[model samples]
Target: MLKSSLNKGLIEAGCDEAGRGCLAGSVYAAAVILPEDYRNDDLNDSKQLTPHRRYELRKIIERDAVAWAVGVVTHEEIDKINILNASILAMHRALDGLKVRPEAIIVDGNRFKPYNFIPYTTVVKGDGKFMSIAAASILAKTYRDDYMDRLAEEYPQYDWISNKGYPTKKHRQAIAEHGITPYHRKTFRLL
Candidate 1:
């Protein structure tokens, strides 16, 4: 079971990112502000769920949340700003897309910069513990997966459709054999 709120009083949004460790494609993040009284036991860390379940939850999160938005930083931007900063910036951009302003934020990881004047808490595995964070994780992951699938069509040799741009042995092998695509993160060690 996941808790509904970090602080019962404040309007809170949970933030998370995906594809930070990928060798190719963009980094994506999501900010999700669920209803204060929301409850859904199936909601957990996105990484814990299968693709079918994640997509199912994505629809639920989108439908039930007070506000939810995804942000993406392209591979080029990741190379320019570095993955850490790009991940945080992607979260900020997601927050920017939210129609309902959050009074506070709870991030899924230990790294974050201040978002405007909104106070934030950094949980080591917030996605597994908090509903909003779990929702954010689902959105970020599924959206990024969708994007990777599209990119896979453009660069089928990278096998992104299967690996979703993660640095699997086959993905690295493809990079070594076929050379780099525009979506490859040059800053990352592809080999």
Candidate 2:
């Protein structure tokens, strides 16, 4: 079972991002603030869950969370600032949209730029250890996957509907055959 919150008696938001390693589409981030007593045995890191499970958990998180929001940074932005900074910026944007201010933040990864002086703790694989971070991971992964599915309609040659813009062998092969699309990150090595 995952812990409810990193600190007691304080509103805490868990932050996580998805698609940072994808060769196409935007990166997405989510900030989720769950009630201190929130519990779900099925909740875990987004990558650990199947698509159906993640979607189901996303609905539960959205309905039960104190506040939850998703933020996105386009491929263009990623090329400009680099994926690391873009991922942090996306998290900040998600935090900006929260209805309730968080007293502290627990992030799934080791790196994060400070958000308006809010104290944050970075945990390697924190999503699997904290309920709130797991919830955020579900939101970010589902949202980014949805975006890529939509983009796949316009560029089916890349097979984004199946690969979801990850740098899969077939995705790279498509890039070689079809060349880059407007959605492909220019800074990323496409070959």
lDDT of 1 by residue, 30-95 (tens): 999999889899999999999999999999999999999999999999999999999999999999
Candidate 2 residues 28-108, lDDT tens each?
A: 999999998888888899989999999998999999999999999999999999999999999999999999999999999
TM of each candidate vs. truth:
0.99, 0.99
Task: For each of the candidates, give the backbone clash count.
Answer: 0, 0
Off by over 4 Å in 2: none
Candidate topping lDDT: 1
Per-residue error at 37 for model 1, in Å? 1.8
Alpha carbon lDDT of residue 4, candidate 1? 92
